[model samples]
Target: MKTYFALIFSLFIAATAFAQNDTTQKIVEGRKNSPDQEKKPYVILISADGFRYDYAEKYKATHLLALSSSGVSASSMIPSYPSVTFPNHYTLVTGLYPSHTGLVNNSFFDRNLKESYSMGNKTKVADPKWYGGTPLWVLAEQQHLLAASFYWVASEAPIKDTRPTYYYIYNDKISIHNRIEAVVAWLKLPAESRPHFITFYLPQVDHAGHLYGPDAPETEKQVHFVDSAVYELTKAVTTTGLNVNYVFVSDHGMTKIDREHTISKPAAIDTSKFIVSGDDILVQLYAKDRKDIQETYQQLKKEAVDYKVYLKENMPTNLHYGTSDDWHNRIGDILLIPNWPKVFNMYGRKQLNPGTHGFDPYAVMDMHATFYAWGPAFKSHLKIPEFQNVNIYPLITAILGLNYTEKIDGTKQLAQEVLK
Candidate 1:
């Protein structure tokens, strides 16, 4: 009886330890902002995933619209090609296109790593090796400026051997009130330990978008949810008297797909000859045999319907994807980007979710995401034209007064246009 009780207690303790790991924030020890760095301005970069470009006006996201109108608002922000959640969010911070960043898709096979990266896989999500480029948080930390994340893609991973000084592993269990409280606490920290750069993410809009089509009332409800929550967030922070800068954006927009007319996985694909990753909107096939690439590309092209097939080298150059820009070689050998509203039902489900994104933003307006900014760092009442998401990296670095000379796809033009 005693032995059994001891074993049960040990198992319980181990389980409790595992659960506790993700439920709280992780702070890096022995890190502090320099006196000069601590004096830098504060920025809370917020992403409401899948919040469409027109959502503020269309859905009446009042706080966001009003805030942006007071500062700067863009017509729309063009997401990197194949606009999707993971790649574009990473792009927003790194100033690199998806192909160059080694995060080519939400789920993609890395040829060199000989492995797959999927958002669902916790182990891969936390692995530093899978991430490339110096994310904004990492850049700030290296320069001795503290950073924090309420949540953002890859913020958990210690890319470049550094993560935000204060961050929590992704968890939906925490309530909005708790999250807001945490940020308030961080702002109240002693100057040396306070964070000047922070990332905040809200997933409710994206969740509703994927489950209920963008046009559905459920999605609208979530949009309102986001609007309310952000209002609360800003209001709470206002008490801190820090004059924090705010830049609100999203990874991609949501589009309703024709579920009744979904495409099937091409019969031409032979699993033995390739490894397939990615989803319906953008299908990526990683070739097992180098010689197999061209042959498969031709075969896919011949049978293609409602989709455009391309050899990786032949993808549209304007996308900044494929051969030359594929510096990390993570893009697949063949690509299949389907026409809008005609998604590939690869998993053989009865149908796909009513709404999804990952289309070329230029071709489908719905693929365009949001961009709005206010607070001390920006010019007031300015509206700019559509710009690529990659430019966000430099815009942020410029605001924080952090310097970098690394060649990135984004231009300094955006900073010149909007900054005060």
Candidate 2:
């Protein structure tokens, strides 16, 4: 009986030791497969323009919701001040605010260029001088990593005297399927030719939102359509058998607007005293001289319009804008941001659509965007609070294992919470 008891005890100890060894092995293997351990990590950043943060809860985006549930998702991503398309998109890749980046608005007058740069002006859009800060693709090239882009804003311009290894100018005519196929083709390139980083921009959702409002059936349909395209793209990438980190984001959200809520300009002030820029939501007024600036400021402040006007010096501290000299030159002498639902109608233009943005980022949730990340780099089943869009730049650089030397506004610590 004693001998049998001893033998049983010995077997129990052996089993415990084996279990300990297995656990240690797993820990080692996990560390080995971690993002930091990978020599060449592939990252795909997709931007679905105007995808609202709440869309994940409102729409039946099965694939996107699955990604959010299985991976790391934020409640929302806050855009920089003057939450508009061009400014926020550039901010995401550059880690700089609109004012610092010099792309303050979709359209602005550059005193240096002596020309008004509008989204419709392809020549100015392609001009490198209009863009400020080094874009991610340029950073990737500096690190000797191959990069590619598909119709992302500023990708057409040669930023920092460098363009992506593979890129196409903005083309709305291209079908979504073709865009997905093109990206997949780039991924299928031989190991030596494949780009280490890639970016894709889908504008259909934003277009639908602008034309048919966020609550419209067309917008919901577009959400599903974009979700389907992303699902297909994921399947294609999986077929390639490459380990890719995927980041899905949007520039800003959309909100309903109507002509009834318009705030007409006061007749006391002359419109010609300053060159007005920006859209109806956020209006920028640039004056020719200090006297014009003071007159415009006083007249705008005295007006009973449903908007708050500020001089460049007294702008909101939270905006983190107007600090750079380039920004000072580009930003307006008098800034006007209308109250929510009350768009500033400088010329009383007919309301073409029921949607717009560029409201106070804190006051209106419609200005917020979506942020979802998944891959070997991110923790699974994680949900984080809303964060600023600027942080995305540092997070991406970290995932790529590239050393970032620029003095960017985003910090890697803000993004490390989602990493495993």
- Predicted model with the maximum lDDT: 1
Tens-place lDDT digits, model 2, residues 34-85: 2322357899999999999998779989999997788899999999988889
C-alpha root-mean-square deviation, each candidate: 3.4, 20.1
Candidate number achieving the greatest TM-score relative to the actual structure: 1
lDDT of 1 at 230: 85
Superposed model 1: Cα runs more than 4 Å off: 1-21
Clashes of 1: 0
- Candidate 2 regions exceeding 4 Å error are 1-38, 323-328
lDDT, each prediction? 0.91, 0.81
Model 1, 299-321: lDDT tens per residue? 88899999999888888899988
- Model 2: colliding residue pairs: none
